[model samples]
Target: MPEASPWDGISVPAHTDYTVRQVPGPTAVPCFWGRDRSGACLFILDLDGDHTDQYRKNTTTINGIDVDLRGEAGRQRLVLTLEEQIDRDLFGGLCSTLIAALGNASDAPTSLAVALAHIRRWKTFLSGRAAHHLTPEQVRGLFAELVFLEEMLDRGGTAPAAVQAWLGPEMSHQDFIFGNTAVEIKSLSGTERSTVRISSEDQLESLNDNLFLRVYRLSDLPDAAGARSLNDQVVRIQARLAAPEQIESFDRKLVLHRYAPLPEYDAPLLVVSAVRTFRVAGDNFPRLARSGLPEGVARVAYDIRIEALAPFECDNDLVFGGGNG
Candidate 1:
């Protein structure tokens, strides 16, 4: 049988805004689980004192959920209400996970911080879900980044340092940065045209640091013997990480990238057929730099043919040499 949910047996009372039962766990702060008048799920954190000044200013909208501070003064409660459109099972998982996070906190402020961080993670996860799965394009892109990340780890760096170098999830200009060197990653189907799209003017602009673009040509073949899925790569990386802190950091970055391991990511297996590295410095390289763009022209995106980058092509060692090259 499946495990029981915290929301089980919780019911909303008639004529009341909510009918709540204290969350059953050893949490640092008092928490409750309930249902609103319309039977929507709710998670409330009862604050010991008025924390409105700290929390109120940070309030922002989250999809499929509502966050608010209710009551006044000594009775103020931080409420999280699940919208009717959201899946109950998912919300239940979120509530339980959040409570577990709060259990590690030692005070109300810490609990509030944990709560906000948890909700922000969910916000990223929910916004990226399409039928509860990432799109094929997203999968391919993420797979490429993982491939590069795994290579970095294999180069003998500490797991924490290598994972921390991944800045793609944070929307940084470069996908991976190590000291004075930066690398941008791209992916494309092996059967498609040999071209990569540069999303912005700053992507190839190395400034004073060295920069390289790494492209992975992947074949999506599920029946092949050497095929692997996105989940396969994620688990492979996880197995190599022995430190709990590094593992947690890696998992958090994955969530921030709008990825959740679902059955769908288990198939339509992908295999990297070839990888090409290109040096992005020198005036001969083909790219649009921010310094060269018109005064108001920003968010520029353009494509660069792989063949045109031949002159600027370099070996993988020069790019992934741990910033020494």
Candidate 2:
């Protein structure tokens, strides 16, 4: 049987603006689940003056939900109200997920930060902008990014810093950005595939900054002893994070990327057959840049043959700096 939701058995008084039930758990901050006079659902976080401005600035319409900071001064509450169009079960899951994330925080400030970050992620999830289920290509793409992220983490840096550097899920032109250096990651299946797809003109364009392209050749090895599925890889990465906040941040990124630990993702285990790194610089590198395109030509996507990238090819050390690629 499914577990009972935090919103289970909660009711709202028809005469009042809201009827709330305090969340039952050892959370760093006070939280509540409620329903409004019209029977709409709500999740409220009672916050202090120190971070009220942060919450206020982030308040905005989240497609099927409304995010706002209510009350004044000492009684400020960051509220998330569910709209009629959203699925109640999904909202319940979201609320439950948020509560779990808040519970991991060490203090009210940390909780507030986590909540704000998560709300932004939920906005992306609810906007209908991301797919509910990751496609095969998406799975491979995300896997390659994770592989790069794992390599970064293995190189001995703060997990939070490394995870934060991953901006691909946020739709950044480059997958990973650190200062002026940017890396665009791609994955190809099987050895015979020779071309890599550049999704946008801005992806490889280097504007007074360093840019590199890293491609992973993946092979399906479902029966292989050490092969890993997408879900397995997620768990492995989570295990490497030392702090609760780091895990929370990474998990939030996964959510923003439209990943869920569904049973369907556990099949067709894969292994990285090979990795190729290339410097996306110099005049000879083949690419289509926005600056070079004709007027009004946008949303560009093109393919580059792998063999042609040889002149620009370089070691992974140039991109990640002394890391095991």
Question: In terms of lDDT, which candidate is strongest?
Answer: 1
Model 2 agreement with the true structure over 218-297: per-residue lDDT tens digits: 88888777789886787667656655457667867787788755556776588998999998876678999998899999
Worst ten-residue run, lDDT, model 2?
A: 53-62
Candidate 1 similarity to native, TM-score: 0.63
Cα RMSD, model 1: 7.4
Alpha carbon lDDT of each predicted model? 0.80, 0.78
Each candidate: RMSD: 7.4, 5.9
Q: For every model in order, what is the number of clashing pairs?
A: 0, 0
- After superposing candidate 1, which stretches have Cα over 4 Å from the reference? 1-132, 322-325
- Model 1 scores worst on lDDT over the 10 consecutive residues at 316-325
